[model samples]
Target: MKATWNGVTLAESDDTVVVEGNHYFPESSLKREYVSFSNHRTSCAWKGQAHYYSLFVNGEMNPDAVWYYPEPSEAAAQIKGRVAFWKGVKVEE
Candidate 1:
């Protein structure tokens, strides 16, 4: 899968974990130059706390458009530190 926004590829990986229809790109596959942590968070009863990231690319800023499970619950352990995109970011094959 490829995660893209603002005409930039944020991450691409052959191996992805899908939960709730969101493809979680491996943390290692992220393009760090275009990514940074955001002071945003959310909780999922089964997935644990989610940390957010801002994607900056081509003079565009997508705030908290990416999220990951830094310390996922047991049921969501597979996505620990893996990222997923939303808010107009595209994830496609």
Candidate 2:
């Protein structure tokens, strides 16, 4: 699977976890250079706190486009350290 935006392939990985229709790509798939740490956060009782990564490609920024559970709840342990996307970023199988 690949996560793309603004003509850039931000991340790609064959090993992914699908939870609630969202594809959580392995951390290795991410392009660290294009990702900037963001202050945004969200919560899910089962998943714990979600840390965000803003996508900055060619000077265009997409805040909170990527998120992950660094420390997941027991119910969501399978997706820990994996990243997922939203807010218009394309996730292609």
Candidate 3:
């Protein structure tokens, strides 16, 4: 899968974990140069707390557009070390 936003590729990986219709790409697949820190956070009963990373690409900012569970619950362990995109970011094959 490839995650793109603002005409830039945020991440791309053939190996992905799908949960709740979102494709979680490997952390290593992310293009760190386009990533920025974000204090935003959210929780999922089964996935634990999710941390966020905003994207800065093509002179545009997409806040909290990427999220990942730093320490996911046992049931969601498969997603550990992975990140997923949303907030208008497109994930496609």
- The sequence of per-residue lDDT tens digits that candidate 1 reaches over residues 1-93 is 999998999899999999999999999999999987799999999999999999889998889999998889998999987999999999999
- Global lDDT of model 2: 0.92
Candidate 3 lDDT over 1-93, as tens digits, reads 899898888899999999999999999999999999999999998899999999999888999999999999999999999999999999998
Off by over 4 Å in 2: none
Name the top lDDT candidate: 3
Write down the TM-score for model 2.
0.96
TM-score rank order: 3, 1, 2
Best by TM-score: 3
Per-candidate TM-score against the hidden true structure: 0.97, 0.96, 0.98
C-alpha lDDT of all candidate models, in order: 0.93, 0.92, 0.95
